[model samples]
Target: FLRAIGKARLITPLRSEGGHRRYSRYQLRIAARARELVDQGTPIEAACRIVVLEDQLEEAQRINAEYRRAAEQADPPPAD
Candidate 1:
């Protein structure tokens, strides 16, 4: 099933010199979520799409938080 996911272009695991697929921690996490969705009756393709969107949202949130922190540091509120 992981091969299917990789074929779907959802998460591409690295190919080792020995031709084995190597998954990263992040990729494994994605695969776990996809499996969970499948267990809940979600179609594999849809599950992959949902997982990708979820990851994108998480990254966006993290970047937004960093920007907010940087702005706050650059312009500390005026001391009363």
Candidate 2:
């Protein structure tokens, strides 16, 4: 599974001094999602793309939430 995703360029784990590839928590999380997709009969390539898009969407949502909070603070709602 690791080799599959690495070949697809999804998650690239770092090489250790002993020449062993080491995966971080972040990378593991992505790999887990890909594995789930693969288990459900999705192709590896498509699964990787889905994982990447999901991450992008999550980041966008986080940024939008911050902007919303800022806007609300800048202009409070009028008294009811």
Best by lDDT: 2
Q: Which stretches of candidate 2 lie above 4 Å from their native place?
A: none
lDDT of each: 0.93, 0.98
The segments of candidate 1 whose C-alpha lies over 4 angstroms from its true place after superposition are none
Q: Which candidate is the best by TM-score?
A: 2
TM-score (all chains, Cα) for each model: 0.91, 0.94
Error of 1 at 48 (Å): 0.4
Against the true structure, candidate 1 has what lDDT? 0.93
Distance from true location, Cα of 43 in model 2, Å: 0.5
True-vs-predicted CA distance for residue 52, candidate 1, Å: 0.5
Which tens-of-lDDT digit does each residue in 1-80 have in candidate 1? Answer: 89988987888999999999999998998999999999999999999999999999999999999999999999999999
